[model samples]
Target chain A: MTLKGILLSASMIALAGAASAETRIGMITTLSGGGASLGIDVRDGFLLALEQAGRDDIEIIVEDDEQAPDVAVQLADRMIQAEDVDIMTGIIWSNLAMAVVPSVTAQGVFYLSPNAGPSQLAGRGCNQNYFNVAWQNDNLHEAAGAYANSAGYTNSFILAPNYPAGQDALAGYKRFYEGGLAGELYTQLGQTDYAAEIAQIRASGADSVFFFLPGGMGISFLRQYADSGLDIPVIGPAFSFDQNILQAVGADALGVVNTSQWSPDLDNAANTAFVAAFREAYGRIPSLYASQGFDTANLILSALAVADPSDEPDAFREALRAADFASTRGDFAFGPNHHPIQDIYVREVVQEGDIFTNRIIGTALEDRGDAYAAECQM
Target chain B: MSAILIVEQVLNGLQFGVMLFLMAAGLTLIFGVMGLINLAHGSLYMVGAFVAATVAGLTGSFLLALAAAMAAAAMAGAVIEMTVIRRLYHTDHLDQVLATFALILIFSEGTRAIFGSFPLYLDAPALLSGPVTLPLGIEYPRYRLALIAAGLLVALGLWLLIAKTRIGIQIRAGKNDREMIAALGVDIRTLYTFVFALGAALAGLAGALVGAIQSVQVGMGEPVLILAFVVIVIGGIGSIKGAFVGALIVGLTDTLGGIFLPEFFKLFMEPASATQIGASLSSMAIYLLMAAVLIWRPTGLYGVRA
Candidate 1:
């Protein structure tokens, strides 16, 4: 064939590729506010997996939500109606996820949630089009409660920010906890001052504290709690003690146990490789957010390899349910509601020279699925 | 609550109030004298905190950090006022708000570029880390007590500076009439810079001092800024005396309400609902106080007719 004929055939293949071969993903997450590091880690991890996979057919579009629900909604609309992305994911906060997920998934776009899996989406509100690789919002906190019960903590003072996720966290703790509550406090979301809360805790004489104040709020609380010298063991979910903010929590973070499904040293092949490769690429230890991002992206890739999700929805959904990819967490399966059903472990913040990261102390809940899965009709 | 607990809470309120005063003192002064509504004041507070943390991290000295916080913030203020704010003096409030809001984005992004997204460490010095046991077995964090004492001392010094000094008189006169002060050959531009720098230093001092207890991170100043605005509004926009009294009122009201309201509700309702109602009400308590004050005295507690 002549050169012109070959060019004509290449253009035909390219046109064919646009309709059938390519996978377009739109990620909307907080990237420019107090919670930016979480989204940044997720983006980096997802991209790293794509790089490792070396897939030419995948295209990613990223946008910053700045932790605002309206912005997330707008971004989702543009992605779905205008950009016509096949898959949407990477929402960091539950509020934003709630705002973006229902509408996007309603339009028949598959949403592979990387970070947030709000309780609303896990139960009666669960959509067949949405799959959360991350645990349901309450899984880790529920595990924390179970850990506290087994660890002989009778009187626990629990605290969380006053938001949907926070409310879910407190409820989750209460579900598994057989302990007597000394106090249950709901603080302002994004509050940095924990002095008054510490004073109350100290005076209450609670045996332990279980708080779910993540990001800067967690750092503030832990630092103040350490300085107050209350001598109470502090336990929480992994968000408060993740590697992203551990160094800032500094000496205070040591010995505080937080529950998570994944850690830097999970002793699995995929996890070990992900950690090493992430450190090599980003020059820092990967957090749980990063792990979730990698897993979510890999889940998409795995499903796409098995079947074109956009072309055949049922086949893609089944492939996703199969859980074909190697997860950073060693063993993983999707629960009935498309959320992760795996082990959640308690990790203690430990120091390795100047570096700080979490080390798995013990398992909190094994082979566990979310409580809301049974409530889902789907 | 026990009497001892009540006493500790009062102290907590005072401590919180004093911190607010430090932030509001600068805000009120800049507003009263310069007639400029600056949304970027929080950015200055953040600047002071980042500088203090950075310096404290390097030198291992809290004193140096405090000094550096004031210096850096004042310098930032001086530079900003001379370059960007001076031109906006005649502009309406909306322009100032938009400009300052943009400045917040710049400061936050610039700080992120330099510090990464992680919070910085600036612990209280060893000398102030332990708790102070008072009589009646009430143990309080010594650093907080010290913070209260320092805040009171600054309040006294501020009173002295405003009441007895020539610069204070000139500032008062300028607030009343900027054109007259300029015509009188008082170097109004320089004075404006000095006032702005002074306010910036105060904000920075608050940030540095508070940074020890709180996590020093990007956008740390924004929350404090909102509370400080409440202080100025209640204290009268330009009145330092008003700010001090207003700060104490706002501070005490916020802290005590947070502790007691929930307990009060717990007496009447189920524990969970009581906590929920109590938390929500306490958050709104300050705004309610502000509203009541406005209804009673429209100009605020110390506000005067312009």
Candidate 2:
């Protein structure tokens, strides 16, 4: 072969090698069906942060889990084994997160959670390989419980779907509230009707009601709760009445109270920029799911800034635990179990002109951990 | 439970029953008349909801949006019946199931392509927005009571249309003996189209009504569809009266079981364990009822054994 032709082939090989050296992160989330709105918010938030970074040195592989735990595990396996993703992130459901965490962590790869910190992982099952950029499973609900106690809402009722997360939420609320319990109703998960429960709530004569019905369940319950004409005030965590739900409930959610770690109305430079950039890109305010996704990506990027991008798995794992992300929550530190320590806020749904958004009424809590954390060995 | 609470729960159960009837009536009619198990029926329901939501957003009139949704779904139903479902009529149930399952994928992806993977909302009309006090001093949402009344009216209207009309006789005949009716000079193909369209319209109506209460998005029909299937299986595959009875039973069992079962379990188990066990069992109660009914009578409660 001629020297000229050999040189040309060598240059083509060199360019391809340069392109393959970029850091790749795999993001799996629900992007279809009922949960699509929240998933879109998460995807947009992560992409926005990546765009702002303006680094061609990183690539994102986005997969839709379709809200199924089996599909999530399959996608995680494919992303790790076939695509060779350097880092894994983005899951909405706690069960789906639980399904994939074991495999991802056992592979000795970094797994950052944008959402869904189940209590088991926050406590006894905690792993150094898993880092949650979101609040613990019970943190927001505990804040609501604290607020309920302060408001003197004794004789309150609790309702939640029957699931691990639901149980954790109720346990979290009862932890802080030293009130007379009226009743607790555990309904089937994915139940669309709330009439019987509403009747029971009214019958119990609870002064207030606290519930944790996330996703479509929340929409169904809040609408029916308003329709039932029960005079008691309804309260829940942000997952039950956030932006995704506001689109469905509209003015029906007016005056309902909730608690969360992140709100779009949070008055901070980091949060303001995050909200503005997200709204510009997605034409809607980011939900907590989105904030968590953006934060997880930022966390990974910050760790990369500290450790060499080309470092081995041991170096990358050390860098991640160092806690270096410029978080929108303003001052987040990881606890021993790798879950975040952050403040939680009590927010009320009120109208700003024609649009409805969560207004921060008070900061009911700060720097809280899951109730089971004292048992955590990690 | 207090008398007021019990009264409220019963009403709630009735409202839920009515909604289930709307969904089950369509599914049963299609199954009985066409002898085809179209799993993608739920996708049509989702389409109706999305169309209603988009129309409501654009026009801001709930009535107009509801009308448009029903019409759009019926039109889509007719077109699909002609182009796709018509070809599957003579095929086996397995083939029909597989083909319709594929249609679900197409419809879902197509919807995502258009709607961009976000939920759309529909608002209740102002006329039915607030609560109304009943004679017993109980306040229920005017819309829900209206829904219960409307559902009953539809059921009555359907009964009259099916029992007292010429088309009703033809449909009953079609369900019983397809070949004999076809030999007697009636246009069987046209009749099938009409039956499918009627079922699709009912499913669409259910979707539009429920859209006001729930978010409209892809796969919204799935849960309702499953419940409807349970309704038909319990009520009998081909009987509207059975659908009504089955819907009420399923609804009450679901709603009441969820509440009372946990309390019952609490007598024996701790609150947390009772909740976990009771909630799981309550969700399974209707299915258990269905299994017992089927085992006792090989056909459903009202089904005519083939």
Best by TM-score: 1
TM, every model? 0.93, 0.92
Model 1 segments beyond 4 Å from truth? Answer: A1-21
Candidate 1: tens digits of C-alpha lDDT, residues B63-116? 999999999999999999998999899999999999889889899999989987
Clash pairs of candidate 1? none
lDDT of 2 by residue, A325-359 (tens): 77888888887778888889999998877777888
Clashing pairs in 2: none
Q: How does model 1 score on DockQ?
A: 0.49
lDDT of 1 by residue, A1-378 (tens): 322333354345433433433777888877765687789889888878877887767767778887889999998998777667889999988888888899988999999899888899999999998999989989999999999998999999999987889988999999999989988888888788887888788777789999998777887787777776678898999998988678776777887889999999999999999999999988899999999999999998899988887889899999999999999999999988999999999898899999888999899999989989989987
Best by DockQ: 2
